[model samples]
Target chain A: SQELEQSPQSLIVQEGKNLTINCTSSKTLYGLYWYKQKYGEGLIFLMMLQKGGEEKSHEKITAKLDEKKQQSSLHITASQPSHAGIYLCGADRSASKIIFGSGTRLSIRP
Target chain B: GAGVSQSPSNKVTEKGKDVELRCDPISGHTALYWYRQRLGQGLEFLIYFQGNSAPDKSGLPSDRFSAERTGESVSTLTIQRTQQEDSAVYLCASSPVGTDTQYFGPGTRLTVL
Candidate 1:
């Protein structure tokens, strides 16, 4: 079975600061997805990376898949209170089901 | 267009009881999935249905957990003899036939007492 590990289980940062969260997989990644969830709410899709060395950005957030495809990072530039949520990384295993990381809890101080 | 929708956003039941969670996938979607998310944990895959093929039940935690999808539209996940460990948020996702990106529902939070 494949597993995903996220770093910095929880983070607290100033509203204007920048932060990065990482997701590492035990095996080569096929399809990697980033999602955000407000406390106790449903997940909101952020982005998806398939090809190695692929990088995509949306608004103030950027995601990059490593050349090896086993690691991915999500960077938030000038984070705001709205960026405070649980960030999860999911990998498509066997092209059937998605396995998710434990998620990184982010908090922004105003 | 409406994303995936789930019914009874929250559910509470006693031990040894049975509970059903429903999910309505997006129109024309060909794949549906069920997952469980425990408190402060990651989402765990439970079952998956694609088109008319047999469902992939390899992720189900136990025999007490089962799910069914009518065509490619609605799906229901039933947990029989629910235990305290079964208390979690049940989530449903759906995707198109050729895509792997799944849109999630609001999820049904189940609590077993």
Candidate 2:
């Protein structure tokens, strides 16, 4: 089984709408990270949540990690066309490399 | 001087051939990693090199995939007897010691026919 799983493989929302993407892990997450990738390009680090119950925000994008450290969510408020990209969540365990989810492709239509 | 860089931005090879992809990490970075992303699939960890030693090769899918780094500068991933399944975008990333953020390269898109 995949160590990390993402919900709603693809999503389309009109501009100015709010959306949320979920990430779940089969095991406890020691460190969770969010990255955004445009088509045909490399990934751009968004934020890192290492502690449980931690929350961080960048512009209109907000990320929250649950207290259990088993799940994390990325929320975008008033989505913009620039927000259209593949959202990937990854988790790193003790002394283990990062494992990424299949990714959620989001499209914000103007 | 800027960020990670990879060479031969794209490659097209036939079956049963050999291919080498290169990666140049940021200056002074000590950790380098290689990953592969197939179409519609998530990134798959292949290998990691910290300084002159690689503590983990567990992610390598097979013996056909091997990577080596000199000091902490440039690294190369070589795949032999390439199969169609090997086609994907290979990405390289580097990070400062103990830092969780990884800076990525443009990636080399490999297409096997």
Candidate 3:
């Protein structure tokens, strides 16, 4: 079985501070995806990284997959209250099947 | 619809009763998936349908849990003789053909008493 472990289960940071969340996989990752979700809502897609050293950025949020394909990270720059949510990392477990990580709860203290 | 949608946003049923949850995928999407998220837990894959391919039931927890998707459109998840431990938020998602980036629905919260 594949396990994608996420670090810092919960975080609280000042409004202007920057933060990073990490997701480590037990095996090689073919595809890594980042998603954000507010409580009681559907997940919002952030970015998808498929190759080693691949990095994608949207707005102030950026995601990168390590060259070893064993880990991925999501970095939020100059966070604000609007960035508060649960950040989840997903990976392809098999053909047509994607599994999610435990998720990281982020709170931007204003 | 513009995005994935699920019916019966909330359901409360007896332990021995059966229940069905529905999911409507986005238009033109050929991949649909079902997942379960228990309280304070991550999403767990349940099943998946890709176009006309054989549906993947590898993630289903038990025999009592079954799901069916009509073509590439809507899907229904049925649970028979539900148990108290069956309570959770069932999520549905859909993606474009040949893509793994899925758009999820709001999910159906099921409660067994």
Candidate 4:
């Protein structure tokens, strides 16, 4: 089984400040996905990184896959209250399976 | 296009009872997946169905949990003899063929007392 460890179980950031969340994997991540979820709601896909050293951004959120493909980071610039949510990282493994990390709860303060 | 939909947004069941959750995938999606998310935890894969291929049940916690998907459409996840530990948010997702992106449904929250 593939194991993914996410750092900073919870984060509190001030509005307009930048923040970063990290997801690390013990095995190679063929595909890494970033998602946001409000408590008791469904997950919203943010981005997916496949190739090593690849980076993708959407609005103020940016995700990058490391050259080794074992780590991925999500950076949010000029964070706002709307950016507060639980950030989760998922890895697509063999046999078409996807495993997710425990998730990081992000709270943005005004 | 309409996103994935799930029925019985929240279900409260007694111990040893049976609960069934339904999911309707987006039109033309060939792959569907089921996952469970416990409070303060991440999503745990339950099962997966891709087209007409055999479903993968490796992630299922026990035999009391079973799921079925019909052709590329609706899916039902049945939990027999529900236990308190079974309480969680059951999520369903679907993706297009050859695409790794998964679109999720609002999820069915099951509370077994």
Candidate 3, position A44, lDDT: 63
Q: Model 4 compared with the native: what TM-score?
A: 0.56
* A11-104: candidate 4 lDDT, tens digit per residue: 9999999999999998998878888866433466688888999999999999999999999999999999999888989876542244677788
**Prediction-by-prediction clash tally:** 0, 0, 0, 0
TM-score, B chain alone, candidates in order: 0.98, 0.96, 0.97, 0.98
**Residue A21's C-alpha lDDT in candidate 3?**
98
In the order shown, the candidates' DockQ scores are: 0.04, 0.05, 0.05, 0.05
User: What DockQ results for candidate 4?
Assistant: 0.05
lDDT of 2 at B59: 76
Clashes by residue pair, model 3:
none
State the lDDT at A75 in candidate 2.
Answer: 98
Which runs of model 4 end up more than 4 angstroms from their true locations?
A1-110
lDDT of 3 by residue, B28-65 (tens): 98888888866544567788788898987888899999
What TM-score does each prediction get for chain A alone? 0.96, 0.96, 0.96, 0.95
Looking at model 1, residue B80 earns an lDDT score of 97
Q: How well is candidate 3 docked (DockQ)?
A: 0.05
By lDDT, the candidates rank as 1, 4, 3, 2
Q: Give the alpha carbon lDDT tens digit for every residue of B32-77 in model 1.
A: 8888866544567788888899998888999999999988889999
Candidate 2 residue lDDT tens string, A18-107: 999999997888778888866433466788888899999999999999999999999999999999988989765433244678788898
Give the least accurate 10-residue stretch of model 1 chain B, judged by summed lDDT.
Answer: B37-46
Native contacts recovered by candidate 4, as a share? 0.00
State the lDDT at B37 in candidate 1. 68
